[model samples]
Each structure stands twice: as structure tokens, then as C-alpha cells.
Target: MSLDTQSPGLLAEPQAVQATADGGTRLALRGDLLDFTHQPEWGAIESDAVRFREDHWLLIEDGRIVGAQPGSLAPDASWTRHDHRGRLILPGFIDTHVHSPQLDVIASHGTELLDWLNTYTFPAEKRYANLVEAETGAARFADALLAHGTTSAVVFPTVHKVSADALFAAARERGMRLITGKVLMDRHSPDGLRDEAPDFGARDCVDLIDRWHGVDRLAYAVTVRFAPTSSPGQLAMAGQLCTSMPGLYMQTHLAENRAEVKWVHELFPDARSYLDVYERAGLLNARAVFAHGIWLDDDDRALLRDSRAQIAHSPSSNLFLGSGLFNWRAADEANVRVSIATDVGGGTSLSLQRTIADAYKVQALQGERLTAWRGLHAATLGAAAGLSLNEEIGSLSEGCTADVCVWDWTQGSVAQRRHELARNLHERVFAWLTLSDERNLVTAYVRGIARYER
Candidate 1:
């Protein structure tokens, strides 16, 4: 466990759907369509997994994908199409793990995971007890995410019910797909931040689940602060909630740092490894997402694969907090679902563009290359699949909500140069990951509605 820390074209304005003659709302965006059909290989780009079509039309009807048609379209008033031929369109980036409360603590100068939590993270989260504070913070956090071309995320709010509700309400107001829960830390935390002292905060979770979960594209997670902060009874209670609530997700930290792993061992002397603590508590499942799985043994990796739980690779946080680099290739080879995330506050930024660049550096340091296909897949469909929400979001398929981003490769002088120097689609797109940021985003849509723009 640890503490730590686009495009072009369209006008930067929100839009409401236009009505057709048949009394239905339709919006079609014409651009270069790109999305992953499946997870690509670890180091190399996969041809079959990628679906890239130039000058295609992504048809959206009533906020759902109807189809993606190719070639020129007839000038019909049945739908409104946004021309973005030079821009790229793909499923919005899905951040599997992040801290909404910790947004204030981002880039705060701190040493390591544990110390950073006590110093910057706790004080900031404590302020979330105020509804106004929580509401304002959540609004900024949600807006910041959309501004960076992320339409969906699994977030970590503070332990306060108000904090969790504020985030849910913010996402709801904007129609963004989001999942979050009140942080559960019954012990090992400051007075104001810990949950009602010692019962794992299940009652609060139930209250929040009833209020926010499954309401307007928002979901609830059984959020454990991490292994160190949660007592045995608390972890067991968290597991019980997962069992009682069929579709509820479980999120927490794992073997992120050397000291944290050692701490987990000390806390749970009978457990074989850090992951074993959660597994014994019945927390291992397909819906469970553990971040920073960098210290586990081969056996732990195998267990995670067999249990169908996923690991979120947070490279910037690992780098900023001095946590070790994650062996994403190893976990994928072991058949474990691995997704990339920002893990912000503990990480440095909410931009997945910068996060992926850091991921490439981290992977390259380990002698493995992260191709554009593999990296983008990890950010989008792979993350959605890991959270078992691939069918609902994260793709441009019929009936899925239209969470999409239109991006430009030629934003600034350097990106324009990179676009010119590129030889193929892969190279230019790879340059988008490295050379581009939120400024290149033309429009980011949540369910066919443009929520953010350049």
C-alpha cells in the first residue's frame, strides 16, 4: 500500500441534440475512427485488435452509438455531423483508479507513500467534510477530467458521505460515467479522516450505495484506503458488502512500495502475501481493481489472474512516490488484466496523455517497449474490460453510450513537425501520445453531448 502522489476542428462549446423529422435526436460525427477491438500484444502493435477507418461517420442516436459508416454521406437533415477528417476519434480514455479528494494534494512536495498521505493527503481530505468544500472540489475535479478528454473514471473520494455524494452529483450533472465511494479507513488514520472508528464504515457505504449507485451513470465502489489502514474486521466487512451487493466494485492499493509490503506482512502475519490479505477477506473478484501491484511474487500474479482481478498501472505515481516500476508485460503474460491509470495526487497529473508517456518511459526502463496500440488500449477498452464495464462504455459499438474524444495531431509547432515527420498512422498516433496533451482535444463527448472542447 502506498500514498504518494487533443485536437482540432469543432468549436469549444456544449451542444444539445437536434431533433429529426421522426421526433428523435441524432448526432453523427465524421472523423478518422479509431478504437481497440481487443487487447493488443504487450510490446508490439496488433493489426486485428485496432479498428481505424479514415473519413468515417460515427452515428449517434439518442446518446447511443448506432453505427459507424464509411465514405461520403448524403446531405440529409436527418442527423447533424461534425466534420473532423484531420482529427482522430476514439472511445474516451477510461481511468481505472484516481483520487478525487486528493486532487488538491497533487504535486505537493512529499517523500513517500505513507508520509505523503499524512502530510498533504489527509489534511486536504479532512476539509471535504464541509459540503461546500466537497461540492466545489468535486466540481473542479470532474471538470478537470473532462477538460483532459477523459469521460469516465473510477475515483476515490474522501471518507465523508458528503464527499462521495458531491462527486456523484457532479458527474451526474454532466452525464459522465463515474464510480466512486467513501474511503474506508477505520484505523491508522487521523481523527477526522477515519471512518467512525472501527466498523469498516459499511453503514455509510450502504447509505451512499442507496443514494448514488446506479443512478445516472454513476456506480459505487467498496473503497478500502489500503491494507495497512484497514483492520481484519474492516476488510472482512468490505468483502461481505461485495458479496451482498452483486455488482459493486472493490478498489484498494496493493504492493506499491517495499515498506508498504513489509507493513502488510506485519499487519497480517498469517497471510502469505499482500494480495493474500484481500483474498482471504473474499475481496478477489472480477470487479476488484488493485493499484500499484509492483511488489507481488509470481504466485500472487497467478492468483490475481485466476481470480480475474485487475491491476492498475500508475507510472507517474510510482515514479513520484519512489515506488517501483510495474511489470505490465509480466502481468499480461500471466493472463492478468492490466490497465493504465493516473492515480493522481499520488500521481502528478490527471491527463492520461502524460500518464501514457510516463508509462512508456517506465516500460522502456524495464527493457520492454510500449507501442501506441498497446498503450491506448490499456487506457481505454482494456481498462473498461478490467472493470467489467466494457459493454457499457469504452467502445464505439452500437447501443453503448457515446463517450468519445476527437483529437488533433497537429496542435503546436512540435506536434505539427511530428505529424509531418511521421511515416504512417501508428507513428503519428504514437506522437499524439508523446507530443500532444489536452490542448489538442477538439471536443470530448459524453453520450453524444459535447461536454468539453478546445
Candidate 2:
């Protein structure tokens, strides 16, 4: 076997079943279908603000939701039926920011952002140089995401080109929509992790983009580790790649930590702020996603808003690293798109439910409350919009992909109690978001295929 196929056990094997022929495939999912038509803001009451259809049925054919309606009957007798009685069916979670190589080091104690990267993150990521090891890590990481009900993600693979290939390969085999790139860092990182030269880094990114961008469900991103890790030449190449490639995504860190922010300012004294580093590099655009935007000032926020750039709010990672609270409300007020994320390794959990819980707490600390509807929307439709992927995987709307999660609201004790006393949909959803984890996921589907089942 080739190196990439040597460790197949590292991935969670799906059940032995053949996919039904494309046109002949029709699967009917019956449950309480929950979908968001728009970003749901907090309110004293819950109405049709967020759409939830009890006793609903969705028709799936060729991996897309052909039709969805509030009824119990399938339109045709040839359809396969999945009867999720009493469970809640919602759009699968979309995590906009996560590091696949750092799954092993998740929850590791560290001093701060820069120190954390030098001490634990870089050392761990450097191991992905081995194609076999990278494949194994990618498989495990992808499985972990499925187990936690994430059907799509914007990922950061290691600087190793093989790392990006391995991750995109595994995600392709499972039909998961993953957007990632070969990390472009030409300075300040360890010897093994940093690119040898600026042109070499740019060439690797271009090659990876050629090999994987727009292939299958995989899309390419131009990833600079951050402002401090990339030299000006490397950043310019990354920006050039972003502008040259159509539909290409640009992802990197922003004002995640105070020290990191100060370092960026010191490193690029000509720039106005940390955001300006990428802005001046011509990397700010609607397709760009900056992670952990916790320390942005008004000017920075305005720049982001003006550029139509997006932010991946990694509340769990921010809290774990003692990074300052993100002013998501301010971003929203400024019309800057913000989506929830699990910045793994630096972040403690892969589960979006846990991230949502952390986000609730984080926003609470800022005296800004996020409703359960809004929080769920952030991980689903809101995140999809942030990543410029709304038409594909974020909702239960007809013609959308069948990436969905079935939640057993009566499973855990807290959920059971909520099920008993819950008079409204909002109350039950709030309880579940606050109290649920991976255990609450009865099953998770990606493109109409069952990848994880409890």
C-alpha cells in the first residue's frame, strides 16, 4: 500500500452500504426540521423567526434535499425512509476555523498565544511532514468532526503540502465539504515548519491550489499563519494568490491575543494596526476569513466592514488562551460578518455545541447575551454565509445538500427535564445548546450519507 493508505484504521469506517444510484436514490427524513431563513437575533419570544417544522419530511435525492415540507408522507413509495421520531433535525454544524494538526494537543496548557504556538502548536504541526502521519491525523480529525455533528469546515492544515493533500483526500472520500490550504509561513517559525524561501512558499501554495482547489467538494485557501510569522514578501505572494484565484479563500489570524497584536504592530510599524498588515497586502476581501478577531479597534472593524471581509469568532480558543473577549455585538452592529468557530488545539473542543456554550458564556461576560436561536444560527446558516457557502450546506431548504444532524433532545437528564417542562421551542433549544455535547447527536449525515451514528 502507498504511504497515504497504510493507516486506514486511523479513520472511522462507515457501515458497509452502497450508495443508491444517483437518480434512483430518494431518501425521506422525517423529524422536527429546524432551519434558519435569516440571522436570528435575541427576542423575548420565539415565533417563526427561525423556522422549525414539527412532523416534517425532507426528500433527498442524489445527496441534495429535493423537497422539504411539513408532512408525514413521502412523495413516492420508492424512497428510503429514516424515521427520526421525536428527534430534532437541524442543519449540520459548520466550523469556520480549526487546525487539523493540533487535535492531539487540544486542551494543552500554555502561557499565551505566541508562547503556545512555539511551545506546543508548532512542534505538533511539524509532525505532518510524514505523509502517513498526516493522513492518519487528517482521518482522525475528520472523524472527530463528524462525531460532533460538523458536516462542513474551513480548516487549516500544516505548512506541509502533503498535509493539505491528505486532509482534502480524506474529506473527499467521505464527501465532506472542507476548505483548507497549505500554510504559508516563511519566517519566525521553527526550521521544519517555515518555508525555506518566499518564492518556494508561494509556489507551494500555487501548486496546492492547482492540485486541489475546486476539485470535488474541496476548495483551496491561501493561509498565512499570521502577520508575525509571514515575511512581507510571503504575505504579498499569498495576497497575489488570493486575487488571482477565483473563489479562493484567504484565512489567517487577526487580533487574537494582545501580545500577538503588539508584535504585529512592532513588526510592521508602517501599518495602522494588525488588520492593516493583510489589508495592505491586498488580502482583505469577501472571501477572506480572519480568525479570533477579539482585539480589533473601531478603525480595524470599519476596514473589515468596508472590505466585506469576515471574522471567525473562536470564543473557546480565546477563553482557553485567556485572550480578551470578542466584541461580536460590535462587529454585528458595524455590519461585519462574524461566525462561530472551534479553533482546535488552542481551542479545547471540536464540538460546535460546546463552542456555542462557550460563546454564550463569553458574550455574557461582555454583558451581551446571544439567544439560542442566534447561537445555533451562527454555527449553521450564519457560518455558511461567513464562509460564502450558504447555497450549499447551511440550511434544510429544498435543493440544499443533506448535511444534517439529528438531536435526541430526550437523551441526557437535563435534556429530558427540558423536554418535560419546555413549553416553547426556544426554551428546549436554549437548554440543549447550554447542556448538550456529542452525546446528544443521535446521528450525523453528510451529503445524505450516514457518517456518524450514536
Candidate 3:
């Protein structure tokens, strides 16, 4: 179904016959249903906060969830029922920060942030200059996300505009909710991967925005790779794009590694702090997303909170690059929005489960506890809220997109025990987050279409 950004709710409802734009069958899932109700931070994640229905029916029509009910009151079978009885069905995962071009660069060894980019990232991204390569990578990347049960993502393509075009086309074909943009980098980089500002990089961004933004479920992000890579002029143009376009999202890296943070301070010497660089460019606000806020201090936290900017907490990437631990508790206490992500390439894997597992370890090393409910929320609704897309894709609420995942807790012996021993819903979620992998995914749905099944 085409989702018009102006009126996303206008997707025509299916008639009583139940059909989808792709001519795919609607989802008639019968299982142990699960979905978030509110941010876990408000209070305890008890029955009132999370919807957990035993032996329930979740109906999806025309790419939207039409109804959810317990077995006793479940509608009589009319359409095909995909029985997931004895499994856990929840909203499909969403990755708030990821590099679609970096899929091949994942697990590249022996480099920190900046050097890693120069040695591995920039070189790998240079391949996307070939549209065929970018499209091929896009196809593989799309499958990888679905295989891991991630139905939606906020992706960063290469500096090449064709990279964003290729990935956007691939995602559009699959009917996934994706936010991506061409990286605006004018300086401090390799030859083939760089683009000039004001005339070239800036204009290409506008053209891309017009070409892809609001087309189907796809949206555009005004991605300025980072302050260090982008010249003052390039950043100014990025800020202009953000201001000119009402709903355009802004994403970039920030305070990820100590050296990178120090360099940002040196590069933008007049700025107050690392976050100040973006602030100076008029790029700090609710629509902006800064990834890897690992080295942020109290002042930076306050700045982020006041500006209403969001942070994409990429635990796996932080660990892989030896960047630093993210202080989740401190960020929350500071009222800075935090969401989880798999910062692939720099991140070890694309699996949100693996990302959360690493997040648990990262927080533990810092003498902080990352609750399972909070982590799960960060991967789903919290991530969507960070991008201001929660109303459309985060939950299984009525009228929300039918992006869902069914997990088989009976996959392994350990899973079986976790299922048997989980007395509370929180415990069950915790076990799944800790032990479950992509292998446990029985099926995954994006816009009422099964994208992955095993």
C-alpha cells in the first residue's frame, strides 16, 4: 500500500473481501500476541503497559492491523490462518541507525572510528558508485534485515545519490518503511566517494528529496555524515535542507569515539562542545538524530534534552570499535530520547537481538542495568518515536502498519526452558532478548506481506 506522507492514514481500507496492494494475502495470525502500550519509563511494565494476549488472533487487512482479540472472542475463521500457536508474536524490530552500504564492511578489523572509516568504510562505499553494485548490495541488505525480523529502519546510504536511490527502490519494492538519505560529505575523504557542497552535494540532496521522499513508505533523511567529514559550507546546506523541508529528518554521527570527539572539538574550535558543532549549523532539534552519544557529558545531555534531539544508542558498534559504553540510565535521567540500533559494518551484526544483547553487556560494564523491557521498547516503539514514525509503524495497534514478527520459543532446549520458566511476561521477553537469535524467527511480516519465514 502507498503511504502518503501528508495523510499516511489515507491508505484505502480493504473491502470485506480482504486484499492488499501487492495482491499478497492478509495476515490472520493466531498466537501469543505481544505489543507495547507506552514507554516503559512511565512505570512498571505490567499488564496495563504491555499487551500480552494468550491464544489471540491478530487480523491484518490492506497492510494495517484491523483487530486483535483473545481466543474466546476471536472472530470465526474466514481467511487463511497462519497458526503460530505456542509462539510469541510481536511488532517487527526497527533499526534507528544503520549503514546500508556498510553491509560488506561488517567485522573489518583493527581500526578505530576515523581511521576505520578511511581504511574500510570509505573504500567499501566507493563501490556504490557503480549502480549495479549498489543495487545488488541493496537487495542483499534488504534480505538481511528481514531475515533478522527488522521490518523498518533508518538507514544511511553512501555519499553517492544512486546508493540511496538503489536502496530506496529495493525497500519500496519490498513494501518496507525505510528512512534514508544520500550522505553529504564535501571534504576530508577519498576521491570517488566525496561530493562538493552548495552546488553539487546540496543540490543532489534536494533532487533526491524530491525524487524519493514520501513515495510509498519511504522518507528522506538529510544525512551529513558528521561534522568532521562535512565542511562548514556543506553543513550549512544540510541545515538549510532541514529547515526548508518540514518533515525531513537529520541523522549523523556524534561523540562516538574519544579521538573522534576530541577531533570534532579541534575541527570546530569555536563551538562550545561536540554537540555545539551541529548546533552551530542549526542542526539540533526534534527532527534531528545523533547516533552513538557515548562520550556525551552532562552539558551535552542537557543540550540534547533541551533541543529535543534523539540519540541512536548503537551498543554493538561501540563495542566493536572500542568506542565506549553508552550510559543509558544517565541519558534517560537527563530526559534525552534514546533508541537502539545495529550500526552495521562498524557494528558486528544486523540483528537487533544481538545489538540488545551487546547493549546489556555494555551497560553492565559501566555499572548500570539495562532492563529487558526498556531495551525491547528501544528497538521497537522507542526507535520509531525517535524518528517521529511511531504513529505509523512501531506498534501493532489498530491502523498501524502490519510489520510483525513471530518468534518460536520452542526452537532450542534453552528456549524451551526459558519459555517454561518465564512466570511473568517481562521474564519471557528478557529471555528472548538474551537467548533468542534470528533462528527463532518463525516468520516476519512487513506491510501484511511475509518477507521472511523459517
Candidate 4:
């Protein structure tokens, strides 16, 4: 039996059941579906593997994909049909590193890395103490992320526990897959920004884990503002928290600027390298997501590879701050899991498309090319792998959550002209990469529900 023969009643029901082909049950997608799986680009070393299918039928039930095929539907099966023929569909983008409270400070004038933090980042982050302000910021942050086709993010809130709570609360209301935590810093910060005591800060982090971790789609992270601002005592406590909470994620900046690297050397003279500071603190592991690994040596790369920690490549921020170009080839050669992200407010744009564009430039500077398929994968499946969330949200594979993005491939005149001239799926993908932005995202869906539509 063909899927089209299946009655609409079955598709309308919420209960998910396996449908036998002979029993006349089939599922269908009612529009032009651009399944990212069409052409899979595994990574920097992998060959082109992305695929594209036209006039496709995707069978989803209970927020999980049950089946997908080209050109037809199962017969005698009931299916929920969504007509999106003129749209482009892809997996929801995953932003691996972002500062939720820093939403207000994005695009502020900045010097270099350390100076930028002291001048703009720290002072802006200090305002999260008020629950009302935090709540407002969280909501705006969530809205901006969703509007830009980001269904999941690993966010950094301010040092205030209320800030983390605000972000988690906002995420819960939107059914977003979010990871966030309070910034833990006990020294070297402005007076108002410092936590009263290291132990007290650690206790708050522990309490937050119990309260917010695993709540709905929310996950808690053990966040440190890098080794410079955190003393040995605080780092040790954070490491203890990681040990106690085996599955929690660890996020912090790493080797982004020359000054920061020099400071790490001065701060931990006994440590072999900057990465060693975190390694000795028991914070290096597969669950850890280190942002901006731009200045790493062979030793640092090797240690990171051995520990299986992932890197969140923020190309836009790196370029905007004049930090340095990230060695994509080096990270790939070391077998490190790499994911692309818009590290906004430091990252000038919220659009993942812009981030991808920046990544291409960053790679070009290193005499490499970042293909469109690979860029999309990095923003989706690659990111999901980095976050250990591949089974849940990365692809539109069977049993994955139905978080998806619908793009208007010809959203603008330039894009339309390019689309008309493009001959194949790969060319079209490249064109979109070069020309598209958040403006091309027609709709954003989370867990089978539409959250934003333009």
C-alpha cells in the first residue's frame, strides 16, 4: 500500500505506532523537503556525503521521525501532512557556545580579547543580579536564538544564580534544548561581579544542578570564566562538582588571545601548559566544550584529543575581536570534535549563516576550504556530536526530535538570481551559504511545534 492511501485519521492521532506497508499505513511530508542527510559532509577530512531529495515524503509521529522516502507515501496509513512545497528544510542549527546575559552587549566596540572583556563584557554581565532584568534578557536571548534557526545552545549566564534560572525558565517555556550555568568567578573581577566565596559559589552551582539540570530539555553546565579569573581554590571546587555530577557539561574559554595565553603561563608557572591548568583540575573530558581554541600547540592538541573534549569554534567572534584565525585543519588532524557557533555578544551576528560565512573566511586564511555541506553539518550534526546530543536533535533521522528549519531558498533578489543560475544541489547549497542569513529562515520548529515563522 502506498502512504498516500493511508487515511488522514492515523496521522492526526498523537500515539506513535509502527505501520506495516502491506497494512496500508504510510507517512508523508506535504512539501519540498531538503533533508540535510541528502549530502552528508562528515568533517574536514571526510569526503562530500550530503544528499538532496525533491518531492519527498517524511513520516513523523509523536515528534520522532518514523520513515522518509522519495516520491510517494504509504497506502492505507493515517498521517499528518504538512504542506511546505516551496520551502527548504534542514536540521535545526546548534550554537555550542553563547553568552545569554551578554545579549545586550553584543556589537559593542572592543579592543583585543582581554581588554574587551574588562571594558565591555564584565561590566555588561554585572547587571544580571536583578531577576526582572535577567528574565527580560533571557527571553530576548531565547527569542533571538529561535528567530535565527537555533533550536539548541550551550549558554553562559552571568555569575548570578538568578541569571541562570532566568535562562532555564525561559527555555523551559519554549521547549528548547538548552544548556547553561552560572558564571563562577571568585577573584580578579569587579567588586560587584565576584562571588562572595568560592565555596558558596560552588554550593550555588550544586544547588542549580539539582534544581535545573535535566528539567525538561534543560541541562546544567559547570562554568568557569577561565583560569585567569578563577583561583586554584575555585578551579578545584569546580573540578569536584564535575566529579560529583558525572554527566554535567564543563564550558570555559581557552587560548583565544596572546595576552590570555601569556597570563595563563604567569598564573600557573608549575603547569606545563595552559590546558594543563584545567587538566590538573579534573575538568578535561568528553563532556567539556572549550570555546575559542585558537592558539594551541601540539601538546595542547594532543592532550585535548586524548581527553576527547570538544571545541566550539567561534569564527565570527575571533575575527571581530582580532583574536586570531582558528586552525581548522589542525583541530581536524588531531581528531578533535569541532562545532561552529555564534558566540554573541562577542560574535557580531546571531545568524548562523553569517557564522558559516565567517568560518569559510577563517578556513581560507589557513589555505583550506569549508564546504557548504560541511558548514551545515558543523552547525547541526557535528555540533550535536560535540554536545553528545546526536541521538536526540542533530539530524532528522528516525527517532530524533522534530526540530527543523524551513528556508526560503529564494528569499531575496540576489538569492533568487543565484538559485536560477544554480544547476545542482551542491551549487544551490553553496549559493545559500554565501548569500543567505537569518532572513532566509521561513520557519523554526522545536519538537514538532512551530516556534517562529517569518
Top candidate on lDDT is 1
Question: In candidate 3, what are the lDDT values of residues 355-404, reduced to their tens digit?
Answer: 99899899899787677778888898888888888888779889998999
User: lDDT of each structure?
Assistant: 0.87, 0.85, 0.84, 0.81
TM-score of 1: 0.95
Better of 2 and 3 by TM-score: 2
Residue-wise lDDT of candidate 1 within 1-454, one digit each (tens)? 1111122322234586778877878988988898888887766654778889888989998889989888496336878878888788989999989999888889988589889988889998999999999999998888889878899999999989899989999899889999899999988989897766455688889999999889989889999989899888888999999999998999999999998899888999999999999999999998999999999889999999998999999999999999999998888789999888999998898889899999999999999989998889889989899888889788888888999999886787878988898898889889989988887788889888888766
Displacement of residue 131 (Cα, Å) in model 1 is: 0.6
The runs of at least 3 residues in candidate 1 whose Cα sits more than 4 Å from the true structure, single-residue gaps closed, are: 1-14
Q: Which residue segments of model 2 deviate by more than 4 Å?
A: 1-23, 42-48, 74-76, 198-200
- Candidate 1 local distance difference test against the native: 0.87
Order the candidates by TM-score, highest first — what do you get? 1, 2, 3, 4
Give all TM-scores, in the order shown.
0.95, 0.94, 0.93, 0.90
lDDT of 4 by residue, 209-290 (tens): 9999998899999999889999998899989888887789999999989889999999999999888999999999889999
Every model: Cα RMSD to truth: 4.6, 3.1, 5.3, 6.2
Q: Can you write out model 2's per-residue Cα lDDT over 1-454, one digit (the tens) per residue?
A: 1122433322255433224555446678788888898887654356465888898887788778887776656556667777886888999999999999999788787568888998899999999999899999998889889888899999999999899999999899889999999998888888898887637487777888888889989999899899898999888888888888789999999999988888988999999889989999989999999999888889999999998888999989998999989988898889898888999988899988889899989989989888888788889998888877889989998889989888887665656877789888888888878778887887788888777776
Superposed by TM-score, candidate 4 places the C-alpha of residue 315 at a distance from the truth, in angstroms, of 0.4
